[model samples]
Target chain A: MPDPTSSPTLTVDSAAPNPAPNPAPNEASNETLGRFNFLAVIGRIILAFFQQVGRLSMFTASAVSHCVRPPFFPRQLLGQMVEIGYYSLPVVGLTTIFSGMVLALQSYTGFARFSAEGAVATVVVISITRELGPVLAGLMVAGRVGAAMAAEVGTMRVTEQIDALTTLSTNPMKYLVVPRLVAACLMLPCLVLVGDVIGVYGGYLIGVNKLDFNAASYIQNTWDYLETLDVVSGLVKAAVFGFLIALMGCYMGYNSRGGAQGVGVSVRNAVVSASILILISNYMITELFFAQ
Target chain B: MSASPPKIALSGVKKRFGRKVVLDGIDLEVAPRESVVIIGGSGTGKSVTLKCVLGLLKPDAGSIKVDGEEVVGLGDRARERINTKFGMLFQSAALFDSLTVWENVAFGLIQGHKMARRKAREKAIEKLAQVGLGADVADLSPSELSGGMQKRVGLARAIADDPEIIFFDEPTTGLDPIMADVINDLIVKCVKEVGATALSITHDIASARKIGDRIAMLYHGKLIWVGPAATVLDSGNPYVDQFVHGRADGPIQMELRG
Candidate 1:
């Protein structure tokens, strides 16, 4: 008799034939089924995309709702502002200056052929203020800040720190996401403004030093052609891009599952999605402001 | 006046993650100032049940009452108000690494209660002392502390508000045997000192016997046995006996999946 404490053993039927006789036929059938389900696969992908968008919309709405409520964490907000805005200055400035310099040089090469070298300064300032400054700064901040937020918040989610906050009578959205959202919204514009100045200075450097244009003329050309609307539109784009970057990072991180691999995936998704949204929204905003 | 109801009561609690049922028909009660421990093997819905009580995860169907008030579908503000009465010690300590020890301990006090930082820090330091931590450790980041110290700091944080109810999730997990016992002792001491109702979930039989007044054994998402801590070893149920004695050969079989 089997020991009463031991788990019962399963008895196999030795006389039964093996069930793998038609493996080749099974493989053919599976291949045929997979080929027939191509549309079903695409349909599933579309459904998943819409589901993700719906979830993100709800998350954004909830975060925005929490923003106007009381129990505001001023300290946390200031900390995020300093992180998302102040610490990001060096990289944003560097990217915009280099971009402006490259644009001025390229414009000079193209415009010199048309006997319009004077337009090089105009092109640099317009591109920098209305397009390059905000776009480049937004992308740089997304890569720097978005990935970090995703990784940090994703780690917190996996480790149960987010749930800990909830049990402590703290709303994770208000305590975590709102401060980040607010800071990113307020700070990205400032970064873009600073970046615009540096970018114009970079173009001025290239125009005067490399292209043999008079320094005063280059400055005057930039100032004459640069419209208030150009800079304002760029700043507005910066704010929107800021919201997208933070929202994507927070959303991806907040929902991260599994473990370190999950956090890694979230970071990648946050950076990629934020960059794409920044580019797409940049075009939309540019169309809104400058389209005839 | 109606006699004071249980601090926490759950009836017919059920939860599932996709196709896998983590909890099924869980029923439990902890009276005022009483300590109840749910002992279960790994993956037995211990944490899920605790989370349902904390409103971190909603049950698919159930009635969860706190102070005889139905809390199952309460609004966010109402849930937050109810949560003010709770303190939890996570299995891994889960201290916010961004904050210092005192700041971590005083987080709920400052952020939740809106207590002044100075006063909250004082309270945090006092609670830390109760958990046998020194003032010097207060300024250090949570990453700076050892696992045992982190658990102690976590305990200190849990009792910082002197909450009416405290939940300890796998209180002795990831510690050496001696350190585990030390934490178990501190848990008993702290729960008594604060006069708080305690609901702890752990697979550590020693911890259950030491810290729990009443012990409930959970198996396959249900309570298989519940008895006074002193009588747990003699529960007479094969599942409970298998768990309490830590036996490999028994009715309880490990579900090993690829």
Candidate 2:
């Protein structure tokens, strides 16, 4: 009865305390008797889901608002760009290059059965740009950068460094959350662009050298078949995925509790949520751009 | 400051987390340029009382005033305006790890007051020196420093911009006796030098006696005893007596199976 693709936010922490916090929630587990009401459980789950969405919405709104506000830290923003975008290039490159090569081989074999080998270039170009490029790059960055943001900010939260930031007259949301969100949103599209090219080149390599196709012919077919909307749609997906990744990372990190264990959980949840949101949004954006 | 209004005042301040009532009804005051310390066991709401004043956590009931102005439930901009006059040394020093030592010290000045970086850096170094740290430690990360050195840096940051009010949350918690004494002396020196009103919360009686003009004892969400720091050892209350002496078998019982 539950659709996994419909939920972008993690519901693990959805049962937030209504007022302050009840540290003794474990007491419920002690009641082994007649406390298991199926309807109550369903209602609780539904309410928790709504609460999580509401919290995520509020957190995102504030982070976006802070992005446009003055007193922005140019140094922090630049540092995050280098961390999220520049440092991520090598990994993205490798992934896309391999993916393109695999696509060329797979499409060649499939199209060869029908004597449509010329269609290999078109299939590789469209698939890489419209789906694989942004999705794979987004997933990789989410694992690398999302987990890092969660661990770093979560540690700060537990250690009271965030509280210290407030006392020092700096807004932690502006300083900590805004820069990462802005950098990811700006950087993921660039990474996806690079990925699309490399993936197509990978396909080209297989088609030309390994599959006995003329290099010039392969390049022409690929260039002619690739449309602007295919690439733009993926780039657009990259931006949305980037924002979702950063938002989940920041939201989880800011709310992390306990200590090291809590931080570890936050990091895991951040990556999972970011990755799922990327897949789901990738589908939605594709529909928006290509659906008849 | 003119004996008309206390520098900081709390009347019937209360806070509760779930069923756990942390601060039932705290009523205390610190006069102009005075050092007042609250002593209590762990989880006795000493930090909560200080947090209420700092506007970190809002009390469920009653009023908190700084310089005769009510601050409870104030908006962010207004609260930040009042907080501009205050500095705090957290229990863990809580220095920014991303920054070098001097940058951490100058953070409030550069970010909050919008001071020029060069000027703020100069002032940071100066404050560090006043805390007995040499200029060589300026570029080193805070993680490179020992606990005592970190506490020193925390104190330096607290007094960096010459704030009007300072709060020390367990300033001497993790330090050796000599280092704790060193910090206490620095705190006294800084308070006198800046002419700032000081409010501190600590279980360390030595820290309390050394830095406090007056001391209050909080027990189970209420301040049961309040008096001059000189008479803390002989406060005539069993709870204060138990806490001050670190007696295990007194009115303050440890929550453990015997």
Which stretches of candidate 2 lie above 4 Å from their native place? A1-32, A35-40, B256-258
Q: Write the per-residue lDDT of candidate 2 for residues A144-229, one digit (tens) a residue.
A: 99999999999999988998888887888889999999999999999999989999999988888899999999899989988899
Best by lDDT: 1
Which pairs of residues have clashing backbones in candidate 1?
none
lDDT of 1 by residue, A113-231 (tens): 99999999999999999989999999999999999999999999999999999989999999899999999999999999999999988988888888899998888898899889989
Output the lDDT of residue B210, model 1. 98
Q: Candidate 1 regions off by >4 Å?
A: A1-32, B1-4
Per-candidate interface DockQ score: 0.80, 0.68
Per prediction, fnat is 0.84, 0.61
Residue pairs in collision within model 2: none
lDDT of 1 at A110: 97
The Cα local distance difference test for each model comes to 0.93, 0.91
Model 1 residue B7 CA deviation in Å: 1.1
